[model samples]
Target chain A: SQTIHQWPATLVQPVGSPLSLECTVEGTSNPNLYWYRQAAGRGLQLLFYSVGIGQISSEVPQNLSASRPQDRQFILSSKKLLLSDSGFYLCAWDRDRGSPLHFGNGTRLTVT
Target chain B: AQTVTQSQPEMSVQEAETVTLSCTYDTSESDYYLFWYKQPPSRQMILVIRQEAYKQQNATENRFSVNFQKAAKSFSLKISDSQLGDAAMYFCAYRSAGLNAGNNRKLIWGLGTSLAVNP
Candidate 1:
């Protein structure tokens, strides 16, 4: 079965600090990966999606960025974090285009 | 510009009763996909059900089902015999369909409906 793993279930970072959140997929190869953020009492907002290595499409413009350094490995990073960056971050994988996605437990990021 | 709307921000239902959460989308594409995702307190996005645009019949999974009206562009989820575990934030999503050189599965999420199952 396919599974998604995200590390550091919760994070607390200071403003202007660098950030890195990693997501890895097991039992799948070259799957579509996506990063999403959900604010408190709000819906999910798609941040970035990668179809293949070194290929990323950003949905919302912000201080955050995403990279697919390796197949099945996706990373969300930021050179300088903002207060607005604080939210719950979720990583999900899709087998192919127009397919349903499987998601990770998510990382709760608190930027103070 | 594709958009999804979930009118109800919060909803409550009695346990063992049925509740329907409404969702509507605005799109020019004839072929697309609709989905309902449940997010528990753990924050894991779980696919509750999905409906393909071309399919006339609704999609069902155990106690969860979707009433997909392609013409009205409305897709609603009906939970039968709702349980306490069913309480969560339900998000309605939409994805465009096309065999593109790029990706065809970028999901547009609605504001979400918070379902609270009361005892």
Candidate 2:
């Protein structure tokens, strides 16, 4: 069975701080990974996705960027965070082009 | 571009009753997938049910089932014998099967409906 590991389940960061949220998949090879953020009482917003190592696509333009340094590792990073960046961040993985996404437990990031 | 719509923002159902959550989508592609995801207080999205575009028969999972209308472009989730554990935010999502850049099987989601199961 595939599993996604997302770190720092709850984070409180000051404005202008650098942010690095990590996600990794186990039990799957070359899986598609995505980063989505959900604001309170709002729908999910896809921030970034990666099909393979070093191949990252930005779905929405924002203060965040994603990178796939390794086959199973997808990282969401920000040079300096903004208050608007506060939200529930989730990492997901899927494969074979059409499977429904399997999500991680998610990280609650609060930018103060 | 594909989009999903969940008409109801919130709905309430008493225990052991039935509740239906409506969803409709706009798309030009015929081959795709529709899904209903439940987000409990835990905040992790869990897949409740899925419907394929080609399958005419509705999909079911234990107590959960979908009313999939291809021509109407509608997909509704029905929860029978609703329980307190079913109280959560339900989201409808659409995923295109086409292999394209940006498509990457990205799911276009609807603003979820908050489902409240009353005792």
Candidate 3:
């Protein structure tokens, strides 16, 4: 069975501070990883996705960025946090195209 | 770009009653997949059901099922015997079957519908 782990289950940061949220998957190799932000009523927004090592694709232009350093490790980072950056962030992984993505528990980040 | 639409922002249902959440999508791609995900107050998304564009039979899981109209491009989720535990945000998602190296495998999401169950 495959499982995903996301760190810093909850985070609070002052404005203009750096941000780093990590995600790692177990029992899978070279899986497609994705990062999404869920805001109340607006739905889950796709922030970033990676197909392979060191390959990252961004969906919407924002203050955040994502990287795939290893086959099972993915990181979401930001140089400086904005108030609008605060939301429930999720990490997901899928075996291939058209497959259902398995998600991590998620990390709640609040930028004050 | 493909788009998924969930018109109902919110819905209320009595316990033991059946509720249907509607979803529609627009896409030019012939091969694709539609999915329904449930997000409870805990904020974690779970797959409720899935429907392939080529499957004629609707998919069902326990109390959950889908009414898939491929020609109409509509996928609606029906929850039987609604429970208080079922109160949550439900999202409709779409994915393309064709592999695009540049586009990758991404899920196009709907705005979501808030389902409220009354005891």
Candidate 4:
């Protein structure tokens, strides 16, 4: 069975600080990965998605960026965080197009 | 860009009662898929039901079922005999069907509807 793991389940960062959240999937190779952000009482916003290593497509331009360094490793990063950047971050993987995405437990990020 | 809308921000139902949550979407693509995901207090996204545009018959999963209106582009979830565990945020999602044909497989999600179950 495939499983996803995300680190720093809860994070507290200050404004202008650098941020990094990692997501890794097990039991799958070359799967499509996605990064999503959900604000309190808001909808899940697609931030970035990648089909292969070194290829990242962003949905909404923002301070955050995503990268797929390895086949099953995806990272979301920011050089300088903003207060508005605070939210719950989720990592998901799908076998291919039109397939259901499996989401991670998610990391709650708070920017002060 | 495709957009999904969940009109009800919140809904409550008595235990063992039936409740339906409405969802509508806008898309020009002919082939696509609709999904309903349940997020419990734990916040894990669980697939409740899925409907393919080509299928004429509705899909059902035990207590959960979907009323798929392809012509109207509407997908609604019906939970029969709702339980306490059913109290959670339900999200409606849309994905293009022709991914191998250049359609992005990214899921377009709605704001979500919070469902409450009363005993």
Report the Cα RMSD per candidate.
1.2, 0.9, 1.1, 1.3
CA lDDT, every prediction?
A: 0.92, 0.93, 0.92, 0.91
Instruction: Give the clashing residue pairs of candidate 2, or none.
Output: none
| Global Cα lDDT for candidate 2 | 0.93
TM accuracy, model 2 = 0.98
lDDT of 3 by residue, A14-85 (tens): 999999999999998999999999875678888999989999989899889998999999999999999999
DockQ: which is higher, 1 or 3? Answer: 1
For model 3, the docking class works out as: medium
lDDT of 4 at B78: 97
Q: Which portions of model 2 miss their true places by more than 4 Å?
A: none
Greater TM-score among 3 and 4 belongs to 3
Expressed as tens digits, the lDDT of each residue in A87-106 for candidate 2 is 99999998855678899999
Ranking, lDDT, top scorer first = 2, 3, 1, 4
- What CAPRI grade goes to candidate 2? medium
Task: List the candidates' TM-scores in order.
Answer: 0.97, 0.98, 0.97, 0.96
Instruction: State the TM-score for model 3.
Output: 0.97
Give me the iRMSD of candidate 3, please.
Answer: 1.1
- Please count the clashing residue pairs in each candidate, in the order shown: 0, 0, 0, 0
